[model samples]
Target: MVREIMEEGLLTSRYQLPPNETKPTSNGADGDGLTDNLNMPSQPAASSLTLVLVFCTFVAVCGSFSYGCSLGYSSPAETGIMEDLDLSLAEYSVFGSIITIGGMVGAILSGKIADLIGRKRAMWFSDVLCTVGWLAIAFAKNALWLDIGRLLIGLGVSIFCYVVPVYIAEIAPKSYRGSFASSNQLMTSSGFAIMFFVGTFISWRTLTMIGAIPCVVQIIGLFFIPESPRWLAKCGREKEFEASLKRLRGENSDISEEAAEIRDYIATLEQQTEASFLELFQRRYANALIVGVGLMLLQQLGGNSAVVYYTSRIFKESGISGSLGLQVLAVLQVPAATIGLLLMDRSGRRPLLLVSASGLCFSYFLQGLAFCFKELPNLKALTPPLALSSTLIAATAFTIGLGGIPWIIMSEIFPINVKAQAGSLVTLVNWSTAWIMTYSFNFMMDWSLAGTFFFFSGISGLTVLFVAKLVPETKERTLEEIQASITHFM
Candidate 1:
């Protein structure tokens, strides 16, 4: 429903910022065991954007590309599937919405799977499931087989939606971390765009095979990538942790400062009790939890998911050619995502999110007006162009910020002791809300086309305030600085 980009990852690294933008004071540990608080002298930041970091990120985001393929595949293949299988509207709706159910299931299991199996392994496993799912769809003759494939694909993608971003964060060079992280959307945009372009020329079955390629790519790519260093640190694999960090940082680089910081911080985390799901609600965690979960809630409620899954319908309803409109939408994603990559750290998360959300509000308002005009006897004749224009603006806004920043915020905000628990909670909320929004969208449109858009506009307007009030400016700060500010170990 997020169209693979909905309510998902965002941010940049320290690469583009000036050397002088550093904090005046150390944000180390509390009187607690956290060492960063001790004013420990900083080491030479590895300013190098090494090939290793880039390759690992590329591998991780192959999963993201596959995810986009999965999201985009549905729209292109929909007409063909319904015709071939003779699915009733209700049956097809299940195929359409079943991904969210699997996503919810994956969300529930994702944090635990990644934490238990290691990020790289989790990704490998997810790709396998996706590959199998695609194969099932490619060969399926009945609705049951199609649903099973779709369900498996959704389960796998929801995991990618979590691990790929987290994996990128862990390996990314702090300098351009946000930029590097933003590449997830870039590849996703690429996959989505490619699917739309090629689907017109290929059979639905052939499309399924194309969608499976990235899954295989990621599976192969995972072999070359190192396990997340933080994960290794968490697992007490000192040698492997250092090795992974060293590989990520570069072979010749001095890993001592970074290594010690990670070790000490993890040690600090080690002293804290691992929080259970219920324990995540404690007052100390209240702020971080609110930011993590609130962003996810508002992100979907803003109607990105609805607009995405039904864009073609929206176009057709406005009397535009749905195929032409979808192609146009496909054309817009890459450049928009590219703009997001360039701007993420330069603008900072809060500013970009504000601009993006505000842009969406404005766009959705325009769309509401378009629908309102459609209701007018005379003005109705001219509403199609307006609806198309407004939809494009909304899509662009979504790609740039609201689409991904919440995830960056989520990954950065949670303390290590409860990150897994927090991740499960945050991811679960995201997919669950997505399902609700996706499910209700058509009904809302039926009730009132103009009203439906106005409702979306209102939610997006509220999102602006929510982000402004609660979302922190993560920028180039270390994860320690972010968490410490929220939890205030003092």
Candidate 2:
């Protein structure tokens, strides 16, 4: 029904490149679309060779991994914490659901903080918050402490989710930016998987402590990495911007052309009047906003959060051992993330999203079917395998596209003038929708397990149409060109 609603509006116009615009290809070196202009001669762009760029991205995504730890923690730790603390199901649910509330707050302020101090500083501040949150969790004596700690960690990771990807996109050379920016989600998946696996063996308190380690490592690592050059330029710190850009590009490579292009772009943006929320409503900004916010809405509403948040519970209900089920998921997500990283640049975003969302629709329908069959004595034998396959397929399908592309597209499509505002709005909606889904899933399942999944399946089905009709191919385009193409349609 949601698919039908969206199809009526979006299906009429197939996505087409602007008539005068030439589509950029990755056929040549420097093909990730960092050219001075479409008409300009091709310049040298090294392919993922700069150690500083690599290291910086690695450091930034440590925060992302920590963010994932916060997300996956509640699922495996749920049983242990409830037993150890002697908490009610209601209390534990509060502990689990409060993170998204914190996340909403963080999303609103992430852009301002990143712009105020710098990306590294914003990350450092987030790490400190996460450290405090984890310590609070580790030492909690009561339910209040747990909720507060969880909320703190949630807030920190909310900032990490927005700032980390944006930082990587700003600093990374266009050649492998897609793959590098994707490392944010890669580490996040790894974090969730590792936490679940480790939680199977360790206590909840010990897992909280383990979560702090990455933040500490990121804090130390941040000192060595240069600030984002685009940010520096945005701040009018011309010398620092040059130094940072050169550092990221490597000293031997020619940075002059790219530097000039960035400076010119920044200069043009600075000359424009400041953009407010009202300006975002202008006809020119319509397509970018729709695609950005629309993808985020689909990602969260499709039930990724509920699945991760209740993986162990779902498995247990299906007559599988929750511990072993979590272990399977621990092993499953990493390979899926690797596949996504490999295909991010190669296959492009739109095709992968369509495929992933279609798979999710099928997987969730299968899950609903499994639950439906559980009531029939004759088909009871099929429930376990069907449930297991559905879970694994859903996780894999989510990681392949919907898990990361929304954030990637959020960073790519918006022009610098509106990026902060647009990013915050998208991030807020993503977390808000996530909160509603995660908080409601348990009750919905109690009402009817099959109904809950059928709802998610419907949302997943709508996502395929959303991408096909609305999302532009952002594969190898420069950030400038991407904005241009999006605004062209508007």
Model 1 compared with the native: what TM-score? 0.91
TM-score of each: 0.91, 0.92
Native-referenced Cα lDDT, model 2 = 0.85
Could you give candidate 2's per-residue lDDT for residues 1-490 as a string of tens digits? 4643342223112233445777566564335443322433223544436888889999999999999899889998998899989999999999999999999999998877887788999999999999999999999988999999999998999899888988988887666888887788789999999899999999999999999999999999999999998889888899999999889888877788778867766776676577787776666678888998899999999999988898887897788889999999889999999999998888888888998999999999999999998999999889999999999999999998999888888888887777778888898999899999999999988999888899999999999998988887777656765665565442
**lDDT on C-alpha atoms for all candidate structures:** 0.81, 0.85
**The 10-residue segment with the lowest total lDDT in model 1:** 7-16
Model 1 lDDT per residue over 1-490, tens place: 2421221111112111344554344343222232223233354654557899989989888988887787777777778889998988778778877888889999999998999999999998899889999999999999999999999998998898888888887776555778888988888888887787677668899999999999988888888889999899999999999999989888988888777767777776665556688877876678888889999998999987767777767898898987888888899999999999999878888899999999999999999999899879999987998999999999899889988788777878886667778888898999899899888988998999989988888988999998878777766656655665565322
lDDT of 1: 0.81
Query: After TM-score superposition, what is the CA distance of residue 252 in candidate 2 from its true location, in Å?
Result: 1.2
| RMSD list, candidates in order | 7.2, 5.7
